[model samples]
Target: MKDQITHLPDNADRSVAKQKFKITNWPTYNKALINRGSITFWLDDEAIQAWYESATPSSRGRPQRYSDLAITTVLVIKRVFRLTLRAAQGFIDSIFTLMNVPLRCPDYTSVSKRAKSVNVSFKTFTRGEIAHLVIDSTGLKVFGEGEWKVKKTRQRTPSYMAKVASGS
Candidate 1:
């Protein structure tokens, strides 16, 4: 008689393997990314000249609403890569800060709440498309802890997948 069951709280083996792929050549990676495209831009001469006449002197009120570019970058990446709230927050804090967006990055909870029910109706309604979605093939992982996966012999397997991880 024998009891054959292997149970552990976490996978220590995988963690070590993951650490091997550290970002050693981050500078090179940043240069390569710049070649692809960058969001930075100053107003062009012609564009600036044209808008000169249309500029208003000033609006008498409290200071205008301002959010850090980091937040916007995170939001944009979330839409582009279709990341979950937590992942989106992570993506921002990890790589997006390199862009120097000039604002304090919001915590994960702040990003989550804003993304779920932000004032997006205006933008959605103003878009040219009737359906409001140009290309909509995407998946979402809705769990905070991420996936539970282990390799049997190198093939990938999905234990579970969700669009919105519970416990928001």
Candidate 2:
């Protein structure tokens, strides 16, 4: 008396139900939604004051115009925004223009030149705790047996391979 099922897989009876997320807190949820699209940009006065390098006698070629801090700041911003050198220069100029700061933005060419010598150290967060890093040994040459030989011959994998695979 029942009709035969032509597409058995198309039926949802065998599939698990998808999860349903319901927001309980209206005020907190609304505030989080509003904050998601908001962006805040701020630079301290100390950094602004140190933007330009102090005039000093140079023994060799040409004296530096912008300070190392300025170069590092531009480079950091560029890296964070994934912007090109010229775009970074324009971004810095726009910020200064809007902020009414009298400082001049560094040129793209200058940034490119100074990048080679400037040592920019990026700060990494380990969730307020010391982070341990493990080095990968896969590319490293193992003294005993080669991976291809062991894999092809169906021999037991070495401990180093296991460690590399587990990333420990």
Question: In every candidate, how many clashes are there?
Answer: 3, 0
Q: Which candidate leads in lDDT?
A: 2
Query: Looking at candidate 2, what is the lDDT of residue 164?
Result: 14
* lDDT over C-alpha atoms for residue 166 of model 1: 16
- TM for candidate 1 is 0.28
Model 2 Cα lDDT, one tens digit per residue, 1-168: 999867767666789888999989999999977865553445556666666777785688788888776777677667645699999999879977887878777999999998878766544322221111111211111222243555688875442221112111
lDDT of 1: 0.39
Looking at candidate 2, what is the lDDT of residue 147? Answer: 39
Report residue 115 deviation for candidate 1 (angstroms): 3.1
Deviation from native of the Cα of residue 22 in model 1, angstroms:
37
